[model samples]
Target: MRLTSAFSILCLSAALGTAFAASPVHTSGHAVTLDLISGQGTANGGLNFNGGFKGSKTFTVPLGSVVTVNFQNMGTLAHSFVIRKGGTVPTDADATDAAFPAAYAPMKVEAGLKTGMTQKVTFKANKAGAYYIVCGVPGHAMGGQYIHLVISKTARTASFN
Candidate 1:
């Protein structure tokens, strides 16, 4: 009787495992891409807040789809990409107004470049909304080294302009 009970438990566990594995996991369909470049660092190959993007002015990606950003540093200094919720992205308005907090905002995922280094990052767009991507390397965001992203249930294939 004990042997039979053990076998039944094993079967139940296996069935539960299969069911769990079959369930779909929820993810944001949003995707992101960034071109990492120096943002006003040391002119002599040092880490400062002076260098910025040089090649691509803006990057357009699909909404609600998984985005993989391939960033590379084409300058002589190191650079980093810092993404944030819409509220945190730098704006022309008053600093006080931009300080308002919102829930479920995107946070920073650092991607750096060391003068020809490349980094890749992939994320799902779980929410149908818009967010800002920028280089938090001090003055880069203010100098227009960042762009807004719109995420939706259906993916978009046009430029984000």
Candidate 2:
């Protein structure tokens, strides 16, 4: 009877594992595409990304995946997007030095990306950890325009919160 009970428990655990494994995280091959908009809402005095400010939204992608960010400036102010190493909002406004090389907008102006424009930045998630996507424009991220980003070692697909 004890052997039978053990077998039943093992089978149940296996079944549960299989059920969870069947629903893998979705991904676009080995790529993750994301959209980010500046000043979609009246948050943080309009210093926001995708209507979220102060790291209100978190994005995650699998390690080694090529990530593409489709960035748009819909706000009234100049804004630029950049990927930085830390999650802390930088006290300074300069956010151009990206943690990962090639993880910044290609058409970024010194002032910022002008309002009513769009740009794209692509890079590989080579590290597994937390990061921040912030505005590279002076005084923009310092005013509160950034979001949390994470590269997961175990994640099979990309997701956002």
Candidate 3:
């Protein structure tokens, strides 16, 4: 009887452990840093992400994760970070307030940081698709201050039998 009880408890513990492991776990997500630089010369400045200039850069994050962006203003002027998931890409003709699509109107972020300032913004990567991270400082994005953010599908974890 003693041996049987010990075996039962062990089995219960294993079952509980497996159950816990199979459950979806909450995570604090990931972080990436970007620098907002103004024009160095005749070339328009951009947000540097992953060692690439804006409008030509891409950042990847897992879906269902929280993404934190640490933006540093390394320029001589003020700038902001705005994120949009859908709609036409803003152009020089669009105003900063109208740059983002109406569908993503709520997901925008404007840090309004001055030169040599830094700010942090966090958002959930619930959707899997291409997102735009742009500077909403009137002419910044139109001047090539933007990045493409790709939210990839989350990897599935193996479950214990």
Among the numbered candidates, top lDDT falls to: 2
lDDT of 1 by residue, 20-82 (tens): 853111222243443333434443333322232321233344555565555555656444554
Candidate 1 Cα misplacement greater than 4 A, ranges:
1-60, 88-111, 158-161
User: lDDT for every model?
Assistant: 0.44, 0.75, 0.50
- In the range 1-161, model 3's lDDT, one tens digit per residue, is 99999979976875687578632122222532223233223345434332244456565656655554556666665666666653567442222442223312113334356766666555566777776666666666666676666667853321111
| lDDT (Cα) of model 2 | 0.75
lDDT tens readout by residue for model 2, 1-161: 99999979976875586478632123567987777787776788778887777889888889999887887888888887777887556644343568776776645534777788888778888988988878877677778788888898998768767
What are the runs in model 2 whose C-alpha is more than 4 Å off?
1-26, 93-96, 106-110
- Shift of residue 63 alpha carbon in model 3, Å: 0.5
Measured against the true structure, the TM-scores of the candidates, in listed sequence, are 0.46, 0.76, 0.56
By descending TM-score, how would the candidates be arranged?
2, 3, 1
Q: For all the candidates, what are their Cα RMSDs to the real structure?
A: 13.9, 8.1, 11.7
